[model samples]
Target: AQSVTQPDIHITVSEGASLELRCNYSYGATPYLFWYVQSPGQGLQLLLKYFSGDTLVQGIKGFEAEFKRSQSSFNLRKPSVHWSDAAEYFCAVEPSNTGKLIFGQGTTLQVKP
Candidate 1:
């Protein structure tokens, strides 16, 4: 079974500052990693995903993630974040060949002016 862990429960960053959210996974083999962002009163939006090929993948809303095999981490990053980026971020992992997703506890982002 695969699981996702987001060590940080909450993080605050200034508007227009860089942001990095950590995501670690526990799996015997390489598992699919996904990042999703949920705004207040909104559904989850797929930020990015790591399936194969490239270690670094680009996603929507100026977001990107890098999959590190050695660390079993797939961390999301943004060079510059905006106030609109404030949301709850979730990390998820899909076990081998299973369509089910195991989500992390989620990290909340607070943007400061």
Candidate 2:
């Protein structure tokens, strides 16, 4: 079975400051990893994904993540955040065959200007 855990339930960042959100997974094999963001009262939008190749992947809205096999982690990072970046972030994983995904509880980002 594949699963994900996000230790932090919420995080706060000042505008123009760096940000990082943690993610950890448990799976038998390499899984398809993804990070998604949802604005208030909105659906989720894919930020980035890690299927193969490079460990570090970049996404829209100046977001990036690195997949680390040893730590079973895929943490999201941003050089500088904006107030509009405040939203709920979810980390998900899809096991080999199944299209269904397992998502972490979520991490709410609070951006202060």
Candidate 3:
């Protein structure tokens, strides 16, 4: 079975600063990852995904992720943070295209001025 882990349960970032959310997966083969963000009262929105080809994947809202096969990591990075960016970020993996997604516990982003 495949699983995802978000080491940081919560992260505080200053507004206008850079942000990086860690995501690591445990799988025997190359697995795809999707990053989703959920606002306070909204459904999950797809930020970015990694299927194949380029290791560096670009996402919406000025976000990008790098797929590091050696490290088994697909970390999400934003050059700068915004106050509106504060939300619950989730890292999900689809096991064998089963239509079932294994998601991390989720990381809450708190932005400060």
lDDT (CA) per prediction? 0.95, 0.96, 0.94
lDDT score, candidate 2, position 3? 80
Deviation in Å, model 1, residue 29 alpha carbon: 0.5
With candidate 3 superimposed using the best TM-score fit, by how many Å does residue 35's alpha carbon deviate from the native?
Answer: 0.2
Residue 46 displacement (Å), model 3: 0.2
Identify the runs in model 3 with alpha carbons over 4 angstroms from their true place: none
Q: Taking the tens digit of each residue's C-alpha lDDT, what string does model 3 give over 19-56?
A: 99999999988877899999999999999999899999
**Which 10 successive residues of model 3 have the least lDDT summed?**
92-101
Model 1 misplaced stretches (Cα beyond 4 Å): none
- Backbone clashes per model, in order? 0, 0, 0
lDDT of 2 by residue, 1-113 (tens): 66899999999999999999999999988899999999999999999999999999999999999999999999999999999999999999999858889999999999998
lDDT winner between candidates 1 and 3: 1
Question: Candidate 1: deviation at residue 60, Å?
Answer: 0.4
Residue 86 displacement (Å), model 2? 0.3
lDDT tens readout by residue for model 1, 1-113: 66889999999999989999999999999988899999999999999988999999999999999999999999999999999999999999998869889999999999999
lDDT winner between 2 and 3, please give it: 2
